[model samples]
Target: MDSSPDMGLFGPESVTWKVHSEPIVTMGGLRSLYLQALHPRAVAAIAQNSGYKSDPWGRFNRTSEYVGTVLYGSTDEVERIASRIRRMHSRMTATDPRTGERFRIDEPELLRWVHVAEVESFLSTARRAGLKLTDAEVDTYYTEQLKAAELVGLDPATVPGTAAEVAAYYERMRPQLGITREAAETALFLTVPPLPDFWGNRALRLSLNFGPARWAYFGVAGTAVALLPPWARKMYGGLGLPTTDLSADLSVRGMRLLLAGLLAAAPEQYKMAPMRRAALERAGLA
Candidate 1:
């Protein structure tokens, strides 16, 4: 890839506009991120509610039951259902933990990972479910995602190209992305709350920091996930905790909103192998 541009992976395009303009198969890119980044525990809850047994990959990996049919189904049908999910979630908004400000569901940074994760998930879970998507199809999905990652501030080289590779990368990077009480509170408040059936003492603390408002929202569930050490966090990353570029801006609430957007947008490329390879092709970052 070219090293001339310093805009990270983006090529001088606005992410919000790009998302709207892009021919993303389902729900454009933002919806993809929501599905990709939906917490594993939350996914597990949904799975249990639906009576689907989650694999070792946890809740987000349960897409074999939902996204699978779409990818393999008629193109028109896939587009219709995907569009509905987006329309419903479009009104869904979340708060910035640091600033208490509200933001839309499809923020810029979030859109990038969403685009990437969906492509990844499509390839990974589909294959696992015994469907065979050609390399050409997988590659086509990946090349499009590389553009999205660049727009979001990640170096194309930094993004993995394949679902399997991305999964491995996450396993490798997991230790550094440790989950602390502070991290948990920040992560939880930044996104929407999990279903009521999923909330508990442990889930409460893992959902937010210790405070009146936090307690009111999370109660004890956050505390449970918070009790987990770095190892557990490492496991969480594999289980669908996001691994994406986060903004470093501290004073602005919007930047924190961007972080929420990013986390909410994770699981870049649902299937890791193709996505990781494509990410490497972008900048040889692999």
Candidate 2:
């Protein structure tokens, strides 16, 4: 385990290091995808290039691995993955249905949109799901994530790094965002993803049986939607508004407890990503 200060992009003392280590933060990934899909061009690109509907689990796993690498991998590993993504994005192109104009996936605006939506989703979900952190800590988390944005070709200085900046970014970008057909389909796919016949072992298969899986998935999806900003929810036609904040709070709290319990019960080796495990060992936390 490398304990050197410059090994990883972010050290243990960073708010991003702490926030991302929590098991509960995994819940935000879908919410971030849903929010990112709201942008017409972004959804168009995904619909055209990604096998999200056909191989949802594969897409999810890939996303999880990418995020984990960024959060916990050594500096060289981080740059390697980031460069791969950047090269991939540069070669991909999507045409605007409305204007018939083709645009590269690595366009600055699209990169910024994706970056902001994802980091905001992660921070918001962690806070709402009962991962305790102060307002200043939240700000620090946002600031630290600019490195991630830069990895994907976004200008770190231009990206939002505070709650206020995020809000303003959303407001400014609102005019360009709306529910496209692709986005609606994406929302549906996320809410009721098709599970594979066999995942891992019998225990996993039983848990993912259609009836139980649909019910459990809807519950988690509903909570994720509920945790979105009101404006974002409205854009999705009020998909997950609880009757009251009390209900929303209770739902999120229950999810937090459930995830915490699962993490505690699972084997330590299974609970953490390989890079994360190594980083923790290096920091003397494993």
Candidate 3:
């Protein structure tokens, strides 16, 4: 038995597709992680249940695959993947660090937080990276992502479905969020993921450890932190002045141009994410 949609939840015309296609969107993924970690129960659920400390890249790879699948897989495949996530989270539990209250990871509130953070990060990062979406298109992107919220058991009405709503939602959620010890550790882990051991070669690992590759990845991480809302940055103890947003926008533009040149120069060699690449081929735009 097999299930594959000739098309996924979105297509070439979608703002979702446009934003997700940019090579620099991975920076937004990192940004979303930091934003999500600001929630106490959200990060607590992650800290108690995730193998991120032991296998950060593996965790990152799985997350990337899930996002790609959700955005590009057929309708049935989307249901399959979402169901698997629902079941896994349903069984996990985390204790609130502040209240000592135990809560299920799949609670609707937590799922909504994660979804909103991803949406905001991806859209904002894409724009900052020079995607040029109009104000109406930004609202459309948010509305389109309601499909994503539904797949995860959230009531679409409860999730933000416009740029204005997203801003309001963040304002409401602000009172509930703050820095936690777990969030600080997660931030450190993200900035410096366990790399060389995962790559596995004596001399090659050393090259990676002290190499331009490591520093370059860190550079992206720095940019991701800069993309966070100013208040979120303050909660993380702040990294820059008011001009940091302007500098980060410039950095993203340069990074996007560099990546585009690299991809064009070596189209056959560049390893785009598998599901993303397949979706592009399916849409006849690869």
Candidate 4:
């Protein structure tokens, strides 16, 4: 494997590096997926081509690995993964049931939606979770993530790179987005993913099979929903909340504290990506 002395993509000094290194961002992954599903064409493409429902964890793991690679891998590794994703998207297409029009998965609009949704979710979740990022740093984080947006075939110039820009982008996209049946179905699946029978631990499987897992899942699902923007929450018909922003804030803060505590107890090697670990070692920070 080729290693770079330079920090790949955003580098250690970048806000993206600081924010993404946190374990709490895992919640943003679910938020991003849920938000993306609300885009009818994106969800349609996913349903047609991906095994998301049957292998949600597998899909999520692969996506997480790719994101980690982009954030922490060598320059060549970053390009390699980005190129692979571009090739895959270029070969896939989905037809819109509403219009009967076939569109490529790499369509600029779809790519932009996925990119913006993910970046916005990440920043929003980190802030709500008490990550202590200043408004300027948050803007920097968004601007830094343009490199990631470009990885998914979006034009960086067209992507939003500030909080205000993101809000404007959502405003512009609101008319095109809604809670479709596919979105609703995907949301349900995300909230309560079925545990595989062959999960290799009988006791764990039994627990999930009974009720504990479902209860735990609902707690997480509720928090993920609470993290959604007010507009998105409304679109989902108040599944996450029917009350006040204060309640949502409190829930998110509590979840953040729980995640932070867990991360604190975990070993450094377990909490960080391998590339990040290596970078920290090299910098004498580990």
Score each candidate by Cα lDDT. 0.39, 0.82, 0.89, 0.83
Candidate 3 or 2, higher TM-score: 3
Q: How high is each candidate's TM-score?
A: 0.32, 0.91, 0.93, 0.92
Candidate that would win on TM-score? 3
Off by over 4 Å in 3: 1-5, 196-198, 269-272, 281-286
Model 1 scores a TM of 0.32
Instruction: Specify the poorest-scoring 10-residue window by lDDT in model 1.
Output: 243-252
Deviating ranges (above 4 Å) for candidate 2: 1-6, 200-209, 239-245
Model 3 lowest lDDT segment of ten: 1-10
**TM-score between candidate 2 and the true structure:** 0.91
* Native RMSD of candidate 2 (Å): 2.8
lDDT of 3 at 175: 100
Tens-digit lDDT track for model 1 on 1-286?
8444232233223222122122222221222333333333322222223322223224344343234323222334445555665565465565543345666554544443445555554343233223335665455446556644543345677666654555675466443333333334434432334333344576575654454655543522322222222244344453222321011111122322443466556785632334223323443353
Pick by lDDT: which candidate is best?
Answer: 3
Model 1, residue 82: C-alpha shift (Å): 1.6
By lDDT, highest first, what's the ranking?
A: 3, 4, 2, 1
Q: Which residue pairs in candidate 2 collide?
A: none
A best-first ranking of the candidates according to their TM-score comes to: 3, 4, 2, 1
